[model samples]
Target: MDIHFIKENIPLYVEAAGLTVRIALIGILCAFLVGLFCSMIRYLKVPILKGMVQGYIELSRNTPLLIQLYFLYFGLPKIGILFSSEQCAIIGLAFQGGSYMAEAFRSGLESVSKVQKDTGLSLGMTEKQVLQYVVLPQAISTSVPVFCANVIFLIKETSVFSAVALADLMFVTKDLIGIYYKTDEALWMLVIAYLLLLLPISILSSVLERKVRYAGFGNTSTVSGK
Candidate 1:
């Protein structure tokens, strides 16, 4: 599979992979914050804010990341707004990912029963305390699988960063294939690069899930601190 060619291009792939990871990590972090805010709004049923969040979630979730990237990179400049390719990639990833994260978090938050919240309140736990101690813990535990999946999905979505001219892994692979006609070698490296990036996260998620279970996050008795 052109081992020499692959070896020679290792540095190029590494640089691209680094850029991809940096952008994905920043975007995912921003998305989680956005999702957390939206999920809280939905969970509490905030009036005007809740509706806005709903619309945003719908818009973000329905549109493709490539479309969002195009709008940010191309459409915005036409209207006097401008961003660099890196900025566009990050924004698009966050925009697309926030909705999915919101759903995951909202579902987790909702799974914490009203009865449990009431029980926490009855025990003299303040509302904030109840949320901090009771609701959030259980919700996070319940949502781990979904949250991890969203993280992986968002990272993979970085493949579209090339649409904005970012030198991400996909961009490098395509560039190599086009320039050298080394399709098989480039494709194999691309798959290996992605596996290197994603496999640890998948493994870590499984470990985290087990840790959550053992830590008694969802256990009723643990919730009550008994």
Candidate 2:
């Protein structure tokens, strides 16, 4: 292991780790917004809009993210649509994450039960109002465990963004290995750096899951906090 090399390049690793996190945080945020809107479209079964959303979700979920990134970063130029590598990576990741999130949310939303929706209607609440006031909050809460897992997975998956020339941790680690020819040391560093990024997220997910369990999302007595 090149301990001396790692020591000297500490600042580089730090910057790269920071970039990885920024990309993940922003990517997940964008993904959530996309998922939310798409889930609503599917839930409401909006005619033309739902078809578009379904195709997007299907394609994003089925295709490899690398292929999507390559298409966005490389293929788009063929059509005169140009985006920076950073933009392509971020957008591709966001769209991919959004597909899975949409399904999670859709399941959560529908899990609120038919009786609950009827009850809301009996109380003179419109369908949209029922969703806004009753369904969506519970859906978000119930979906947290899955959502958290997806967030962490998305963070790890950002490693592939290195392929697109993003200066994320994986990219920097690869750069270091290339420059120093210390594959073992660089990989060890990569593992530790990724643990630093993912461990806290795992712990937080557990805590949130526990809270949700105590909330009894599927029970009649417990109401959604959101």
TM-score for all models, in order of appearance: 0.93, 0.93
lDDT per residue for candidate 1 within 102-197, as digits (tens), equals 998877786688888999999999999998999998888778778888998898888888888888888898999899999999999999999999
For all candidates, the clash counts are 0, 0
Please give the CA lDDT of all the candidate structures. Answer: 0.87, 0.84
- Which residue runs does candidate 2 get wrong by more than 4 Å? 218-226
RMSD per model, one decimal: 3.8, 3.1
Candidate 2 per-residue C-alpha lDDT over 24-120 given as tens digits, one digit per residue, 9 for 90 to 100: 8888898998999999999988999999999999999999989999989889999999999778877988999999889878877766888878889
